[model samples]
Target chain A: MIDEHLLDDLALQNGLLEVDAKLKLAVGIGAILIGVFSPSPVAPLVIAASMAVCTIVFAGIPARVYAALLAIPVTFVSMSIIVILFMTGGGEPLWDVHVLGYTFTLTTDSANLAVLLLSRTLGGMCSLFFIALTTPMVDIFSVMNRLRLPDEFVDLSMLIYRNIFVLIGESIAIHNAQVMRNGYSTFRRSIDAFAMLAGMLFVRAWEKGEEMLVAMDARCYDGKFQMIEEERRISATGIATATGYLCACAGLAVLFRSFRIF
Target chain B: MHIMEGFLPSPWWQIWFIVAIPFLVLGLYQLKKLFAEKRETIPLLAVAGAFVFVLSSLKLPSVNGSCSHPTGTGLSAILFGPFITSILALIVLLYQAIFLAHGGLTTLGANVFSMGISGPIVAYALYVAGKKASLNTFVNVFIAATVADLFTYVVTAGQLALAFPAPAAQGGLLGSFSAFLVIFALTQVPLAIIEGVIIALVFKYIIDVRPDILVKLNVLTQNTVNRIREAAS
Candidate 1:
């Protein structure tokens, strides 16, 4: 979702705005449809398949990169499934394990449910991953601003997006320093390093906040972070293309609603 | 609770969402005033948001296999009052819904109202009580945590009651609420404790190191709070 180098390169290149707008429209429409239409089992599968096609078509990155990105939410889904399967004990137990005077039953329904839930979540994540991969981060901020999000929130997001790379670098450097001092091979040391990292981040962020405030004041900063909102004329061809894609999605949604596919 | 799509009846969720939109717009408009007055506060809000997002990504074991992240509602409430915290929470929830999928659009309202409004109000009230009683910081935090956790559950219960039909055995409002509480309690109590501890530590550290941060954040007034402390002591 956050590729700093790609974002910087795209921002440098001219004609990126038009590309971003079109991609934004496609992603916006798709996300809305997914949110509204894909409420059941079959729709999620269909969405997943469509997302797979979109990933292949739109994502310039390799399949492995996509898979690595998709692994994040996939892992989360797996954890949820495992927890739910063990806890939700009902419907003709497939297997029962007695542990410490407690009977843990795993049912066929639970297993099926875990798969269903995992697939649905993975489908959503994959679709989102592709959307983020295709759309640059700065363009997303522009879209959010254009979509009438509050200026403060938009500005906040932009700043966070901008500084995230710097912060991540700083965090990595700090981690390396800590590791060099004493290797965090032990579990306790690893946790201690994490806690130290968090505390350091907090302090750094706080100091940065003060410095940023002072810098803004020094620069004769007004309260609002103003960016020129360029008015772009929407070409008829672009509108037509976007409309066609939107109508197809709407059609799919209507068809699914009528048939109760998901 | 991160309500999934289609979990609630479409009509009900749609209705609340519709109702929520106007409040959201109105709230945003009202927030415009605050933005112009104190632009520096934006970074503070951003820091709070970024910290919450970063810390939340680090999931800690709570109960069983269900993990819960720090809501940071108490801290937000302590710094900014509940009213502003509501708007901040809504914005954060919007980002989370659109970007992370941690929470859903339909359920954002209920989540905001619970974590944003109820948690802080309860925490602040507890803090006030603790102040009056001259209680220690840890005691104040524990009280705040317990009250805030209970308050959110109660509000969530009401929401469940509204969403589901009545009668305990029918697997409707009461039954669902009970089931949710039982499931939620497994993680929520521990999550609350973690949050309480973090907030307390942050509060203590801020008081010692950079009291100016809290002062600028409007969490505590310099002279008034000092006077109160001196008198209490």
Candidate 2:
């Protein structure tokens, strides 16, 4: 169960783990914005490539893992891109098709829009991965606190963060037990077993919650949860490098604004 | 099944955020009030939110060998309320975006609005309708959870259609809506049914194991629990 997804483990072991979380967040968000705003696909495609390279090459994330993560959206996105390509109209018609008595036409504008959409999504997802791979949720908690989010919200977020693992661990144990019992030997049985698992999961989590409340109260549970103070000072070089990257992307976007494949 | 990060363009993303903020504020406010009255709810809420995360992670065993995860919003909305479920969904979506990059931060508003806000409301409404109609507990939970699961994707499809209204696509918005709907909503129908079944089974287990918790949470009254137990025994 855990093998399917365990991103925090990656963040903990990343090469850029020690870099400032805020800096990483800024770069990720900046690149995402630049990618989104660019009318052309060129800038977003560049951002996507650069961000993927940074995550895999700079941050030491395994190439296989990166590709696997990226593969998650390929099916849905390709479908979406195709839909946009065939459904949108205007500009020059590049191709025409007659299917089921409907005349479907692909046009220049649609092709350009499809490519742009595909690249923007690619860039956005990669930039998000860059942040996810580089920054641990603990650091993000501190960042959230710094951003003036309510203490209660931050505290609850921390609690939720901690419990996700606990619950996942619990789930894995249950899933294993179910597997051992021949719970999933057939498709129909598997559905029943999985339903039982999902049902019992919340019940188990509720019990865990009560146990945790007792644990916290025993430890003098206060309304406040402490934030990890930011240790890495924001360096001039980090800022300059991030700024340079954002500027380059913005400039590329402007330069290629009118460039189109169709 | 989230609209992966960076899918929605600028103005649409910002518009969703704006639409979602007031609801979030109301949710956060409701949570504060709930916490003030019952201190235990704080942990309960956290765990419930985590429950959503865990639920989403649990893959359904599909016949075709494709993966589909349950939305858990229907169950949560029934146990808690829509207000709290919305924020829980927001938290869960945020975690997915930041850690797993399953959804985009830019599109979190849209995702939350669909999965968190709209799905739960539909579930809650169906639940109330079921309760009023004196429907069987299993059937009630089944329909509510199922339709809610399906409804979330409809909202998502609508959002996409509104955002990307192709001018030349025959019937324009209506035509493109159906096209997008085929991709976003049609595929989800089977998964949604599976989710409903799983959630209905979950409710059965909850009723058998912790009927008091259900009563306390206001999902079912003590009287209804007694009647159900009487009928069961």
Candidate 3:
């Protein structure tokens, strides 16, 4: 079902922010309710399917790229489940495999458990991804501010986001510097190199902090952060959509629970 | 831990949302303090940028083919303090949530609580504790790094417990905690050590070469001898 049509939809847009914010508020509440009240099997798949559909329709990204991006965590979750399922010591053992002083037994429940976990994780990630990809950063912060979060929290979040890239660049430089000088191609050498990299990164960060403090004091700063714009209010339509989506998700979860389908 | 959708009972997540709202509001209000006197924090911003960027590249080894990265809020906490650091952490989490999918939008509150708030507070607390006792700078940073990592993992464990409850009451909590602890122990210890060493070395070099800058940031005092004694003692 993963197709190429969705691939072209990944482009960023002005409306994407509204769509994403609305979806997130809706999905976040909905998912939690479902997690608590809904039954298994059907509930998990339905949730996953709905998210998949959203990713395809609203994410504005190619389906393949979406899949690829999702694969990183999904793969980890799936593998963990697989290892857990087969290695677990319950249910009818299909076979026993001994490796590295450990015995792994495969069972039906384990397989079922694995599938269930993977499906839930993938579905959840994809849905959340859809919202993030669609929404612009500033607007999301605005929405949080509107939602009644403190101004400091919002501003700090902005600062953190701004600095992340800079920090990553410094980390890479330290890493590269280690590689060039230490030649950490071997396991032990790599560990030493890694230690050195960590050491260098911290030293650089502290120095940068010192320089930053001087700059701030020179400008007469005293621990206050201010943003340039006014906060945006949530529209009625946005509120309505969020409410309706949440209600539907809750209703569906309740319905599934009543049916007792696990 | 990023709680996937439909994992925790809805009520729990809602409660977290509620708890987070006020803290967030208070944080916003305090933000003015970070720049109250119309001071330029561009230098701090630059440092923040560099710190986060470098942290991103240092991956922790975990389950096969998987790795977890330190939130790195500990160092941020020490330099920027918690209130500002929390918000900054939120921003970092937000970007990662969108571009890298390392976190999710819905779980932003939880992530903020863990990496943003708790991590830095623990780190800062350790720094204060060390300072009170007159421990060497390296010892202080190392202990802070270690404790911060442990506390962050504990917070992560609490979050995961919300997401997936243990099937049985007696053994479930222990099982879940152990599962996560095992994974964290495999990865976080080395990361903390590295981070601690990094902070100490950097702080030392800064003191030696750029005493004025440190004093400006309030990291070091205008009296150089006192600062050295502070570090040494």
Chain A TM-score for candidate 3 is 0.69
Q: What ranking of all candidate models by TM-score puts the best one first?
A: 2, 1, 3
The segments of candidate 2 whose C-alpha lies over 4 angstroms from its true place after superposition are A1-3
Return the lDDT, model 2, position A71: 84
Give the interface RMSD of each candidate.
6.0, 1.4, 7.5
lDDT tens digits, residue span A43-154, model 3: 6566667766665665545567766776656533543454345433335656677868865556555555555555556556665665555655655666676687654445
What lDDT score goes with residue A254 in model 2?
A: 98
Fnat for every candidate: 0.10, 0.69, 0.32
lDDT of 1 by residue, A150-196 (tens): 67667767655544444555566777887788736664465455555
Q: Compose the digit string of candidate 3's lDDT tens values, residues B1-233.
A: 44444333355656666666675566555656545653356445545744664464356432333455656677677776777676666666666666566656556777678777787888988887887787876678767866786787678666665454443532455655555556555555666655565556556655555566556656545764365857666
Clash number for each model:
1, 1, 38
Give per-residue CA lDDT, model 2, range A86-133, as digits (tens).
888899999999989988899999888888899999999999999989
Q: Which candidate leads the pack in TM-score?
A: 2
Off by over 4 Å in 1: A1-18, A22-31, A34-41, A61-127, A163-200, A228-242, A256-262, B4-9, B15-30, B61-68, B97-101, B104-107, B145-168, B221-233
Per-residue lDDT tens digits for candidate 1, residues B6-67, read 33334556665665556456546655766777667766666655654454444443444554
In terms of TM-score, how similar is model 3 to the real structure? 0.70
- What's the lDDT for all of these models? 0.57, 0.87, 0.58
Model 1: per-residue Cα lDDT at residue B91: 61
